[model samples]
Target: MNKSKVLLLKNCSTGLVSQVMTLIFQFLTRSLFIRYIGIELLGVYSTFTSVLSTLSLAELGFQTAIVFSLYKPLAQRDEQQINDIVNVFRFVYDCIGAFFILASLALLPFLKYILTGITVTNAIYLYFLIQAFSSACTYFLAYKRSLLYADQKDYISKIIDMIVNVIANILQIIAMVYFKDYLLYLVLKLMQVIVSNIWVHWVCARLYPFLKRGKINFTLLRSLFSNVKNIFAGKIAAYVYSSTDSLVISAFISTVQVGYLVNYTTISQQLKTLIAGLLNPITPMIGNVLATDSEGESKEGAFKLYAVMRVLIAMMIVVPFCVLINDFIAMWVGAEYILPASVVVLLVMDLYIHFVHSVNVDFINAAGLFREDRDNEIIAAVLNITLSILGAKTIGLAGVLLGTVVSQMWFWFGRSYVVFKLCLQADKEDYLKYWLKNIVDGVALTVSIVFCAYLNSRLPIANSYLKFVCSGILCEAVSVALFGVFHFGDPEVRKMLKYLVNHIGKR
Candidate 1:
């Protein structure tokens, strides 16, 4: 096997293992948290996580641009150029870290306003401080890990992160159970972040001993910052679009409601993280392919296969999610903690939309079209926030998630258009067919969800866990069957199935 395929397998296998372990620990921690601590505190944890995530947007997508810049030099084995780029990366992160400190401090007074309905205690501020410090530490200390990412050595970091997460989750569980102190739990979380980053930094340094302080390449730095400026707009838009939902809920509704929502989101996020982890290996390879493939034939073929895979994966996930999410929540916690059916369906739909387009979004970044999609991202951001706030006040939680689904509709077609026109340079008919196919896939997904929901309603299982398991199995089977019925004749699907079967047979 070639180097790229080997790297992809290594990354995917390690990432899958990491995500599975992390998911288990996350549920265990969250379960202990709700049982020992309070759901309100869980809400606070979820709220502050979003707030800190939003604050971290000060990094302004520079890491992405810098990583993109590294592809060519690394591909050519130009160590000097790589070192210079790393120097630029180091300098930029230092500045970002300093700025993060100042920004976090400035936002301290406003925390009272953001954490509405919850008492703004000094311990809360201290917890935020520790979390902020941990985040800033990444910028100042762990920026070298990006080089590993650009080098397609992400499996190294994945393994380190998995180890750290398991250990941290174990420690946090002990703290929550024995100490029963939220502050101690937060401290353990901080330690986890620091330790993981430090490990990645060490691995990067050992692997790339040639990395050292060097003269900054001003011209390359300038070009990178130019990409950063365009990418920054999209970064802010993305941050506002996704991270602010919690903030809006906390401000308009209650932190306790945010806590209720967090349970569902935890499941969604864990799955999304797993999906991203499995798919992330493909990104650097895509970048490498784009850097070298001038004719776009290889890019188009890979994308078509990935597009089908994306739909298949989304169908498998979203359908089961719609059918079984509430049952799982009830089984995991209690039915009282569950959100309404409307909210659950909307949440699953939102996840479906995001999962379906995740590949295209990654492709857009690989194509370096941040500047092109700047306006579209900004518009979506504005639409999401506006609609979410309004929907929250008017129709409540379901409406808030509904805003997310509506806003992302623009992204679904908009991203595909840009990828086809600029990236692939495909003809109009191909783009139209892709759009039509996506529409059919969306319909199939929605119909499958309904069918699965009806099937789940008819299941005779009395036990909660058993019901969840049975519903999940039936939902998945039905979703896959529906997908095959819709796309069995698709040339891309046939080619992909043949490819997978041949590869598995070889194995």
Candidate 2:
């Protein structure tokens, strides 16, 4: 396991530790929020988290710009360049921190307007301020955290975040169980975040001793800011995509519905995180490879590994969600919280499409292709916003999600063309055909698995828990057996499998 495999394995391992802890915490805490905290406050809590994201938009891709800059220096082992880059980033992040505080306060007057059905105004503001301040702490002095990832040591941060999240979530649950005070629970979260930021700064110092002695100059800052400007559009696109729906849902529908949406959102988000946890480590490897081989002569092999990974991960999540979301939701919470069938189907479809789109995006970002279709991201964001608001007004929640689906047409087509042309220097037809073939294989295998599972008489059960468990296991087993046989029969797939096994065995 060298760079690519090593990075992937470590990231997945550490991410699993954090995700397992988070899943446990979320299971207990979400149930508690519904039972003890009421749906309205749950909306407030989730809403403010969204609001904090908007406020933090002032960050404006500074950290990402810094991380991208870091790849060159880290690969070259140039300590001074690394220190200079880190220094400028710290100053910019500090300014971004102060901007967030001011921006959040400025929005306070309109907060009640954005949120529907808010009775306790002061509590909302206080909670918003606390969340904002706690988040800002990381920006002020934590810029050095990028080095951990650039050096492929993200496991350090992942482990730290896991410990903090586990402890914090546990304490918050206890506070709710004992006091049942929303404000108290929020306060504990803020304190835990503050502590985590400080701990991250300490870890950064311990890992990179050279960071403490560096002189910053505008020349360096200006050079780094160019990367920042290039990637800023991507940053906006991501934040807006993730957070704007909350605003729309809060403004148009009742705040309570936003809480209900989280029932579906929680699972979607966790699956996305798990996938990212596995794939994100490969990004730096891609960057390193491109830095050395700009012609992308290395891409065809990488694409095969990525294509297989995309199919496996996407099906592992989407097939189950499509087949068993209703049953899972009914068993976990209740039938009452489940959305309508239309919305459920759309959500699962969105997850599948979103994951497929994300596969190329990691490569695009690694190749510094953000500036290629920066304007198109603006178009997509605007389209999503307009369509979401109108769709929610016309059809309902499913319509709102459909807006996001429609907007991704650019990603599936436009971005792929650009990456295939500019970065990989490969034929667009070949790339498109590869993806088309993957979609066909995945869909056919999924249907076959579902039909076989149904034939097994393991589905359509009366009991919710039994239906979810039986269908989930059968779906996974059948899908694996079929997909494995389908791909393992390919010489290319067999060659890659042998290479991966040899690499890991050597490690």
Candidate 3:
């Protein structure tokens, strides 16, 4: 195998392992929290985390901007340029840390208003303070990890994060079992964040010793600032897009409803995280390709193959999710906790849209086309918030989720246009053809999934767990068969299969 392939495999293996471990620990922790601390506290905890996530915009998208800036330098082995970029981020992060602290404090006074479905008086403030400070302190050293990512050493950071999270989750479980104190739980989480950031920083410092040397390059800094400004706008939109669901549910609906949604979201988010971790190893590679071969035919070919893989994965995941989620949720929590069928369907549909479009988003980021797509994201965010609020007021949870589906469809179109026109330099006809093909694929997958769901419902399994297992198996089988029939002649699919066969034969 080639060096790039070896690195890609290594990164994917480590990332998948770490993400699986982390996901297991997170589910365990969440389940324990619900069992011991009660659902109200879970709701409160979810709300506070959402609020703090909003505060994360203080980082101002610097990590992404810096990482993009490093791709070229790293590819060229320009240590001096790498150091200059890292130092600029280090300085900016320190300022961001201070700013987060101040902003968090200013927001503290209004926390009471956001505190719905919880009766904790003064302790909540302390919890927020610790969480806020932990978040702030992360900026001081977390910038180093971006170096690892841009250099295709993501496995190192992933491993460190996994270890830290495993230890923290174990400790938090013990605290909940023995003391039943949410305060101790939050502190444990805080320590995990600090340790993970510091560990990554130390690793980067050791791996690239020159990271400590060299001053900021004013020319590069000016360019980075431009990217940051554009990326920050997208960052705001992203935060609004993902983070506001819980907050909106808390305010417009209730925190308790947010808690229930969290149960469903937990499964979906973990799946997304796992998929992202497996796929993210390829991002820096994509960035490297864009840096080295901006106009090369190889880049476009790679993108087409990637797009096919994403569509296939999305189909596979959404099918099982649609068929088995309600049963899984029933088994994981209780039947009462399972969301309304309409809400569940909308959630899965939204997830499918995200999975399908992720290829374009990743390419857009790799190509550093944030400036071109900034307004697109802002518009999507606005639409999401507006639709979500109006929907929540009118139709409740389903409406809120429907807003996400609509916004993601908008994002899908906009991002595809940006990637084809700007990044790939493809013409309008080519872009429209590619866009229409993906839409057809999405629609076809939806039809297949609906059939799979109907088949699952017709199964005669009586036991709930057995039914879930049977439903999952049926969904997987149906999805594979349908996609095989649907894309039997797809060149990308054939090429991927041939590569896989060759790889296994070599093994």
Candidate 3, residues 162-197, lDDT tens digits: the string is 888888888999999888999999899889998999
Task: Give the Å error, residue 196, model 1.
Answer: 2.7
Models, CA RMSD each: 2.6, 3.3, 3.0
Candidate rank order under lDDT? 1, 3, 2
lDDT (10s digit) by residue, model 1, range 264-294: 9989988888888777767867888878889
Using all chains and alpha carbons, the TM-scores for the candidates as numbered come to: 0.92, 0.88, 0.90
**Candidate 2 stretches greater than 4 Å from native:** 1-12, 71-83, 207-216, 284-298, 428-432, 442-463, 481-507
Candidate with best TM-score? 1
- Please list all clashing residue pairs in model 1, or write none if there are none: none
Per-residue lDDT, model 3, residue 346, is: 90
Better of 2 and 3 by TM-score: 3
Give the Å error, residue 303, model 1. 4.8
